[model samples]
Target: MSPEAPPDPLDFRPRVALASLSGEADADWARAGSEYAGAAFLGGIALDEPTREAARELVDRDRTEFLPADPVGFVDEQLAALADSPVQAGFNVRTTELEPLHEVGAVCRDRGAILEINAHCRQDEMCAAGAGEVLLRDADRLSELVAAAAETGATVSVKVRAEVPGVDLPAVARRIESAGGDAIHVDAMDSEPVVGDVAAAADLFVIANNEVRDERSVREYLEYGADAVSVGRPSDEPAVLDRVRDATEAWFAGEVEP
Candidate 1:
């Protein structure tokens, strides 16, 4: 059964966040919504297949963005590097087939910014390891991981592909809530072509990404019920975020609010 959705109350207002698409962690963090005066996300979710041959084949390909060698450590250093910025949210660190997430969780908790557990990645290697979408095949275990991380007092948010029959979006959202996740971040599949626009499933606060980079699109997602929206990639042009931020500011200002 699909999980139940969160209630339609407790509205929030978080500024726009730019998903770090720039290759350099420093550059990505540095850009962290400064121009837009909003929020920033560090590191793109890592889709790096552990095997070398597969890794080479997947670089900069598809919806996946692979990471450099040593993902766990990379997430650590990147977190440290971004310490002083207004930016807080960092992308999900893969823990599917990988081992020992305790140390990783500790690092993120220390930084005061929560780490996202990626259950949405569709890349081949991540899938092969029973990570990402593969985890969707087993919801109970996914709930455990989300709950365990939350126990650390470190926020746990799962990024997932849209709910297929077994994936059951509403049920999963409840598991996430039961697991103590502060929010749910979904990268909607086959979302509308408009930039920054999203197709939200329910009332849960959504941090929707992919194909979002402008004002109107942001409004579309908000209309669909996203608490906040994530921007990146195709919208890398400067001011893409500025326009979005302006629109968001205006909306939240009670002027032209969605």
Candidate 2:
């Protein structure tokens, strides 16, 4: 049998997003696997000044083992690879300081890669900086930024958090659609995924993530409306990436929609 075709986001029925952290090994590790169909921009974002320290702190806290001791060069390597890679790359960039987003988005567009704005990182260091949660509060601006990024013609996606604590998700989704984002990567941490509410994809796409610890949860995400679903931490468990890959393939083939 011919090898399974490489993942084409446009043709992908239900996709798997692998979270890529920053570092030589991290990137290499990501490139090491064929099981994961896509990558998430969930690594270091502090490449410039005034906030570099904060970015480092966040990485250290959230991904100590993977993050490098000297992150500036580390991030540069990742950026360089992202610039040079022929295949599509993944990203979960920080919006707290919108410095390098445009240039980065340009690269993604040129490469047909998907670039995501992360409002989903829950690290306390990131949350306190008026980035993830704070940015969520001003859904209007968030939508505008997402739309602006979409101007590049790259598949611009925004990864959002659980949307709890009185956070109105339908309102957020509507505004994101009104803007220009291609999709909202919802980290459905506390609740199951919801498709109808995301119809406002504004001609974009929706990729569900988080709380997908088992086969049943993955099924729920697709049934609920996610064009695709991301599975991470699962890869960290013992021999779990293989399981995730198998489960995702089986689930998509079944194509159970709600």
| Maximum-TM-score candidate | 2
Off by over 4 Å in 2: 1-14, 20-25, 38-44, 47-50, 59-87, 193-196, 199-203, 255-258
- Score residue 107 of candidate 1 by CA lDDT: 67
TM-score of 2: 0.77
Tens digits of lDDT, candidate 2, 117-209 = 767656666667655655677887687668767777767777776655767776787787777776777777666644446644345577777
State the lDDT at 108 in candidate 2.
Answer: 62
**Cα lDDT tens digits for candidate 1, 75-182:** 677777666655554556556433335556676677666557767756776567666677777878787777767666565567766634456666677777776776
Q: Which pairs clash (backbone N, Cα, C closer than 3 Å) in model 2? A: 41-91, 41-92, 182-204, 182-205, 183-205, 195-224
- TM-scores for candidates 1 onward, in order: 0.76, 0.77
| RMSD after CA superposition, every candidate | 7.2, 5.3
> In model 1, which range of ten residues has the least summed lDDT?
192-201
